[model samples]
Target: MNFAIRALRKNEQRVAVLFIMTIYPNKVSASTSPFAFIKDYSGIPREQEILFSTHTVFRVGKIKPTFNYNRLCEVHLTLTDDNDPQLAALTHRMRQELCGSTGWHRLGHLMLKVGEYNQAEELYNELLKKASTDSEKAHIYHQLGCVKDEEGEYKDAALFYEKSLEISRKTLPEDDPSLAAIYTNIGGVYHNVGDYSKALEFYEKARQIKEKALTPNDPSCATSYNNIGSAYYHMLEYIKAVEFYENALEIEEKTLPQNHPLLATSYCNMGSVYKDMGDYLKALEFYEKALKISEKALPPNHPDLATFYGNMGQVYHNISDYPKALEFFKKAHQIKEKALSSNHPSWAAFYNNIGSVYEDMGHYPEALKFYEKALETSEKSLPSNHPELANSYGNIDLATSYGNIGLVYNSMGDYSKALEFYEKGLEITKQASPPNYRGLAASYGNIGLLYRHIGDYSKALEFYDKALKIKEKDLPLDDSDLATSYKDIGSVYHDMGDYIAALEALQNAFQIQQQTLDENDFALSPTYCCFGKIYRGLKDYSRALHYFEKCYTIVQQVLSEKDPALAIIYNNIGDIYRLMGDYETALSFHQKALNIQENVECNPLDCATTYTSYGETYREMKDYSTALIYLQKGLHIREKKLPKHHPDLAVIYHNLAKLYLATQQYNIAMENIQQAMDIAQEKLPLNHQHLLDYRETFEKI
Candidate 1:
């Protein structure tokens, strides 16, 4: 410890830390001496030194600052012998994965495994120059292709893979297992470029070859199944994706060691599929299993471990556990920063996820900052023509980044800026080769949402229909994405004063949800909420309450009690009670809503809804003074958050007009009613229910 501290004191450039390592070696292992004490041969005989073997593995333990010095730390390490189960299993799997005919080949494979892509490429290229056989040249080409693939040069990867395939075909049998590996590589290149159909073709070819050439439970076959599953996942064919993923998992569980890293990949793949299916609990189960195995089989800062963390974060994000989600996201980012380059395409995903959590929390400026960081990272790391940035989810292309920014702008009430970014994203999606239908659908849906927010019901319907048409043509009938399209169209129709059309579209969405999701799935909550709103518009109080309660039940099952989304449901239920003339019950629910909305970070407009609901209930009970206070509070938030002519603003105006008229303040009521009339005349359809209500209130005044 004194020797290490003395050495650190000689560096004058900056503060340098000294790591005093305490190694606990396993003396019971007789196979090898992992360390040797060499005091006799030391130049400084008084300072005894111990030398450890090059390949000795250590499990890191406690690391803490010591000796009251901020820079100095004590690190505890346990040296692993051959008897260590985790080390033994990881070594065994790694040897199998990196199997090669020569030490040089194994060295090249190791370089690739440790993410030394440039070194691996140079080694393979030099080896290619000296290759004596066609098989040797083919293997070297395939390795080079892997290097390019890891470096995000997909076109070069495809070329190298094709070269290897061409040579292998001429030299080897048609059913060679080696050829299947090449085919899978080619499929991966296609997958990275967002051409799922082409990727599927190559993946299927690899699967067929593997099945014919290998045993029924061969681990190689599992790789093919996983590749096929990933393609289906990208294509939005969740059923097929699950089937293939389970097939891969079955083979892996049967053949691979429990703690093998490949098993972690299978588990993560299954988790991703479940997460997208809206089965968050199941997703977390699989992600935990994957994380446990990865912790045992890989280094602490391995990129694969980061992927597991990212998967766990995604599940928490879907369930609206923002703090837990952010915690997991930052953990993943810490690992990624250690394992990957700063501008690596993978960084975009971490940035995007954290941005999404902020967006949902209604922190638009913070969300936009992270979204722009994602865009910058993506542009720096990915090719111009690359459809998706290709993260753990294999989603979030450059187009998605633009759309994310647009969404934040839309939430911030900068509609023109939102539309500009949305249009840019749409154009990029349109230009994607082989036509990324799924991405196109999402872009169209975003634009549609922007239009709906601006009260352009006809324009919203146009874009939503375009999105729905593409989904219908490309996605399975029971796909959750298809259900989302139905929900969007339904919401627009509900806004356009077409109750029958709204009910029909919502029913279509519900049917799809029933086919694909559990009854209590969080995805079904929004559909139920939409159904409740439509019934409320029709004055069917009982049916409206029934749907609202169903929605609330699902939300309670999925989200935390204090989640901002829960506050919205509370406000909805309160308004339903008020409509049914149960003022006390309505006030109780409104209080519950305010308890959450006032304390949490959420859209000011959502908080305004609760205030307005309280005002309506109080006015009905003839509490005019309290009603005015709540109405003014709601009016202030709406005016600040929404555009001057927004239809939602008109609703608040009409509510205030009713409260003022009930108190016989005719002049003040007339002013509020005229403001509502002006907004409705400019923004809403003449026959819209809100406009009709405004007219009725005008007559009363």
Candidate 2:
């Protein structure tokens, strides 16, 4: 006999319970009472039992058992009574069945959904012991993998996922949904660990199966598309990421409800892609769309809402709108604080975002405070050597925290302290299994910058070379990061006065930037400026002016009118005109630069550089009195701001000696020449060209 129990709603307030029982002859007789089993099993009172029948195949057993035993005897019972006790008993039985083996699987899944990772792991492990078939074991293992993944134990999660895949391959048919699911899980682990290439590989594997097995516009397929888009986004393949995100959105728009969370996710992913591509308006449009959907479909304090706010904060930060960025960042932090624990990684991310906003606003102390909070959260939540804490793959949040703190120190002019934190980050990166080349390069670059600022040109060049070598090995030829490496090496070479090497390195960087960057990209401005400086050093005034003009045009388009960066371009142009013997034109440009420096709260060193350039141009034009005035102003500022023995001070003294000699102030010229020689001897190498020039000038005096 077969029995089927179905619940059907007959009206607004009544649920009609239908029981279809098929009985064979000799197996059970109708006169023996089908209702007897229910009475005995459930122990319900006979008066409470209300049953209505639609079909009757059995009489009181006297109607001749004409049907053979093989023939089916079907009985249908419908209970529409609102207060029937038998209905409650049947509902209890159904609930018990649901809480059995099949129910345990659902319970474990619920544990995972609620972030009870340890509990889910325990439940799934216990279920594994009771699994009878390989398919059942595979499902349990897959759930275990999910638990580990949520706990941020990526390596263990990957191993468990692979084990599940192994079992699935052995027991399931080719192209099974189980296989696709395991493949997707494995891809997620790789994605979390910063292996984008491997992530794409596994994602593609899952995608192929899903495309073949599932109908078009399946939500599961949309998930696969979203994963692929995320992998591409992290890889910095922004256009390709957009393609996949659009594919996911197309499926979602067709199959999902207007306010579905998955549709919101698709919108958020699209926003991120536009953000990375520097299309801030488009990014905000998508983010707002996602926010609208989330507000309608999610709780007020949902963590996904926090993500939307943080992303908008990042967009405002990039645009240099500090107050707006802070507003959004704080919004994100508030939501995350309410929804997540202090030690949650999401909380850490929120802290980091807030820190970034403060850093951009030049609030170093506030930035450090929030960055420290992020570090504390990460330390509390993640293991010391966990991939999320530190990994050579350059994706660890801890490494970023260390690097950001170093930047704050550097900006405060604490070079030694900056180096300390930068080296700490580098050490963590070095300890990662594969030694994250990208992280190593970043640390090296930071250390190089500190050395450069302290005037240790050789040490700066050495660190820059280390960074460049790693970038060359790890990045593609046309990658913007690789261009940055070449540009750094070129700038270091320029600082060291190796103009030939500087030209070659800068050219390499320019070519790569031309290939990879947009025509109007601000990143190209520095490279153009460097070219101008190199050409000026080589005495190619026309070529130098050409590059300087290019830099000026770009800077004017990207930055504000009073920006100090534009002052640098004007100063460079002035130097070029002075060298070309166009003294009046040179003075005009120099005056423009000087006016900007005087009007703005400029760096003292930068203001001094303009004064020195003006003095030199006056001396070339034979205006001794005016030259002396500008020279004295430059010397006074340099004396106050620079170390006493700085090579730059020696240059100023040398220039003063030449001016005095030209004016036939023989005694003062000799005195100034000797002072220049002494400072040069102390600060410059014996074989340095500047030292040789000082010696020649001293002999002439």
Candidate 3:
């Protein structure tokens, strides 16, 4: 036993290990008597130090709460293998305390406090079955349902909660706190099942009930407030969420002790809302407050501690302090792995979060490695009916990974395969998540982007609208996430030449971002650039240039000069000059954009659109051969970076065909245009304007 303890302290875990069996000095029947005092080590021992002298044995009669361990560990722990009656003494006291039904419930609560969920569940179940009163039954069912919910049997768990509600409704007043709790539990089950509207409905009902029953500022009412807060949080109404969480905290601080778990929960909820609202430092402060109480009140391996760690990790991640995020996430993961099996919903969550940090670092292999592990763990262990299983699948099927792999295939001119995986991921998300779920919105966004890649802006807008409608209802009014959805829709509008719609969307995004983010935030730079492009499309060159300068200044301050996104801003600025017929300025900006990308990306394909812009400029100048050369360079880039049948590839192909004809390669021009026409009609809508143009061009050929 001493050797085992020393090895564990040194962290030298080995397969072969000693086990200790607790023995009682049994004075029972003859056959069981000898067997009880001496037992083999095939057992469970809750603690380690009973092999010392019997003189130190804990006696039953009058005892102190605990002996002082404060004086012990400075000197190395000595293990004596001498026979001792310490285990017998402790066991005798426990048996005396645990002799009745009241005693069982007390011991069971202690087990729950220590996180012995199985023992607690068994004891609670037994007590509930034997319970005599309606109030007791309702309370027992509520707690048992909580244990079931923790086990992720949400529907079955809902039944238990409903049964508790039935009893509470019959025995308790409608506005009783007990009845309000029944409603809250049902709402939580609904929230877990992706029925957020139903969740909101029930949580509101619970709040109203509690508000009527409890006195103003009563801490018991805070449970209802917390319920409402959680529902709003899951619904993505961060501001409203903060309001409710704060209301809960105010009441709690007035009526409950500061160190209570409920107070910590309110603090954590407020912190998460602040974090989502982009107040990282404030989020960190609240998380630390929650952590201080939790560390003192709850066990180190408590599941709530895992949530604290996760929230801390997210706050650090938002601040770009990745090392701090990693440390907290690892601790969260360790505690969760010990407390719950790997397939638990929180376990799946931490794996996805840790994987996202790796994703941000451009470590695609490592990110995918972790995602695959999470998916495998979830799929194998989670019930087929579990919603988290679908979430895991959705994470593994993320569009970014598909887009990356598609680019790889496109580099190999395997456009078909790229499209296949994108379609697969899109289909899975549509089937798995609810209609209003963010996963569904993101899927639509990905499909729209893919359609735009294929030169089907009309089709792109069709999907973008579907995505935007969902995002608008769920995202906060001024949320930064809205920026991307607006930008994507604006780009589709731009391609369709709907300048009014494009300007409205782009300007809305830009205004919201400018309000929410710092002037120098890198994300704001793209928003400015997008607004400039929309203005350029509207033929407002002065306004375009104004926004372009904003973008350029921000980019210069925040991003490296050689960032690939920098090229897009530069080219948009160049386009404004080109449209104004300022050829020298156009060439200057284009050259700077090209120089930056060439140095940083090194892939000619990355600047393919820039080459296309140069070719278009030269064609306007009637320098036909140079235009042909640049357009051909553009085509070679598309061949390297886009699927042969990709709409973007077809656009470049069509441009090259026109340039070829201008250079008098009539037969070659006709051949390329015919292939471009096939790609357009096959991949794009029949009513698509580009499809119409290509068909007309093919007829002329």
Candidate 4:
């Protein structure tokens, strides 16, 4: 064991996995030799080696880091014989499911089941040459299709499925159950390429044939129902998705054992829909149920078990429970690390999820590191044009990896860098066959946000409108994503100072949230913040404070004390107090905001907000010298992070002008007011409130 460990440790950069098997020969018949001692025949006698049969089965046991190494682990395995009921039952069931005519065919099917796609494809191609009948050829072609589909070669998968279907149709009826399986697989190929409507058409065809030919509660029918539900889920029809998922779950519950992996999968499907619908508690409940069954039915490091953990992590992440989300994500990552190759596509998603948590925590550098890792892994595992890179399922697409990096850059106020990545993602999404509309929408939304930040309101609206139109056509009216689109549009309107339009859009967003999400859900935080900003813009001080406080309360409940969002909320609340002429209270809140902004790894722009707020409060209190200091600090950050003509820069310039005027510095006041006027004229609408205010300040100077 020591020699093995040392030999593997020679590669310092690569992780090493060591499996130690414990076998009891007495558990099996004396004549059935599954493994043999080969130490005596070895040239190096000091190194003991045992050769195991190809079909040897083992029950995985405890796994832990070895030798205090982060990347090395020891996995314990106990050899299982025919006497092990679970192993025997699983083997029998798999053989039944494969249902091949020969041992070689069965082996090929099993290889596909275990994700040995290349081996399965090679085996099936070889078998095809020797096939004696149409039935045999059809089976080989179908198996090849499955292998190609798993490899993300959707065009090949489709062609193979078509070949199999053409052969099978000559002898099989249109409603034949065997034909349903081929139709379902064809639907899967369409689904992989983001053609959900086409996928649904085939899924419904499979369901219809199953309903007519199979027993009502048959597991095969449940599989069809699950596929239909997944299509609806991707189409953002949550109610229809839930209905089909429940139908599948009900059948599975009645037909399968409590710990069956299929039952677990049904629960996971339900959980995912609820998670997307913003029902976090219900999502968590279903996810935990899936986890319970998966733990009992699967090996400790099974990839399916990891999926359950990742689902729970996503629920926690959506609710802003960062630590719990991190814990679950890390658990999933560990399992994948131990079970899969380093370049496996699943690792890209794991890295992306972990990076998202860090990003939300304002750890920009850490977030960028993980996002880049995800991008690198995706590039290594897939072809550049592989549609699976944008799948939005377990796989990570190249576009998604780029978009994630863009999000971190956006948060750090690197707008040009953010735009570069976002455009790259958009270009990829645009190039996808069948035009992956969902990926396109996400890319559009990201670019819209970037344009909004850089003071290009018209461009922001253009991209945002494109995204909204897609959502309006593709998603249910009350889908959370649709609400996000509305909220984003409302925010842009607020920035443009179109108070009535902003209110209308925000009301639409809030109504959808009220219908789909809990009142205190963190998903509502941004809507509340937008409402507060609109109220403040309208000079409704009391209402603005009320809305800001409401946002603050939910954010406090969801995020950590030092969260970047919390600092932003604090700054907003302080600005509300300043508007209400509560100088002392405003300063106190600004102090709190500054404390967090100064200590954490947050964007410099967020720190600038607190500084500007403090400067405004100090100026109102007639402390001109101190106001100048704070305003200069804010100005320095804004100049570094924002575009010269950004609306936010204009606001800060106006504040500096006010401070200089209060101090009777006429020349400096004129210079500052002129700068503010120039930015406002360039970035804002002619009739915008900021532009009007800048005009008045210019007159005074």
lDDT of each: 0.85, 0.75, 0.69, 0.84
Deviation from native of the Cα of residue 650 in model 2, angstroms: 4.6
Question: Candidate 4 — which residues are off by over 4 angstroms?
Answer: 1-59, 65-73, 77-98, 102-106, 122-131, 291-317, 320-447, 469-475, 622-629, 695-701
Which 10 residues in a row give candidate 1 its minimum summed lDDT?
386-395
Top of the candidates by TM-score: 1
Q: Assess the local accuracy of residue 433 in candidate 4 as a C-alpha lDDT between 0 and 100.
A: 59
- lDDT (10s digit) by residue, model 3, range 598-671: 67533455588888878777876778888877778887877765655777777777876776777778898898
TM-score each candidate.
Answer: 0.93, 0.66, 0.63, 0.80
Per-structure clash totals for the candidates:
0, 1, 1, 1
**Model 3's TM-score against the true structure:** 0.63
Candidate 1 to truth, TM: 0.93
Candidate 4 residue-wise lDDT, 1-701, digit = tens? 56556766787776677898887867766767788889999887776878888987777788888866667789999988757766565556555677689999989987776556678888988999999999999988998998878765676788899999999999998998889989999999877665778899999999999999989999899999899999989878888999999999989888776667788899999999988877677888999999998886676767777889999999888876777898998898888877667876667778888899889877889999999999898777655564452344323277898999999998788988998999888887777655667788999999999899988898999999999999888777777888888888988998899998999999998998898678887678888889999999999989988888998988787567877678888899999999989999999899999998898767687798899999999999999889989999999998987777888988988998888887889898889889889888888899999899888888887
Task: Kindly report the root-mean-square deviation of model 3 from the true structure over all alpha carbons.
Answer: 11.7
For model 1, the superposed segments whose C-alpha errors exceed 4 Å read 12-27, 30-32, 62-74, 381-396
lDDT order of candidates, top first: 1, 4, 2, 3
In candidate 3, stretches whose alpha carbon ends up further than 4 angstroms from where it belongs are 1-116, 126-134, 253-264, 274-298, 312-331, 346-440, 469-484, 494-501, 508-525, 535-640, 645-701
Can you list the residue pairs that collide in candidate 4?
389-397
Per-model C-alpha RMSD: 2.9, 17.4, 11.7, 5.5
C-alpha lDDT of residue 433 in model 3: 45
- Residue 30, model 1: lDDT of 71
Query: Which lDDT tens digits does candidate 1 get at residues 1-701?
Result: 56556766786443444544555544437777777889999998777888878987777776777766555677777665558776676678789899667999999999888767778888888899999998998999999999888766776788899999999999888888889999999999888766778889988888899899899999999998999999989877888899999999999999888998889999999999989988888899999999999887676777788889888888998988988998988888888887677776667767989999999888899999999998888777654454342421223467788899999999988999999989888887787666678888999999999989988888999999999999999888888888899989999989887888999999998898899788888778888899999999888989999999999998898788999888888888989999999888999889989999888888788888888889888988999899889988998987887777888888888988988898788999999999999988887877888888899999989
Top-down TM-score ranking: 1, 4, 2, 3
Output the worst ten-in-a-row residue range by lDDT, candidate 3. 69-78
- The total of clashing pairs for model 1 equals 0
lDDT for model 3 comes to 0.69
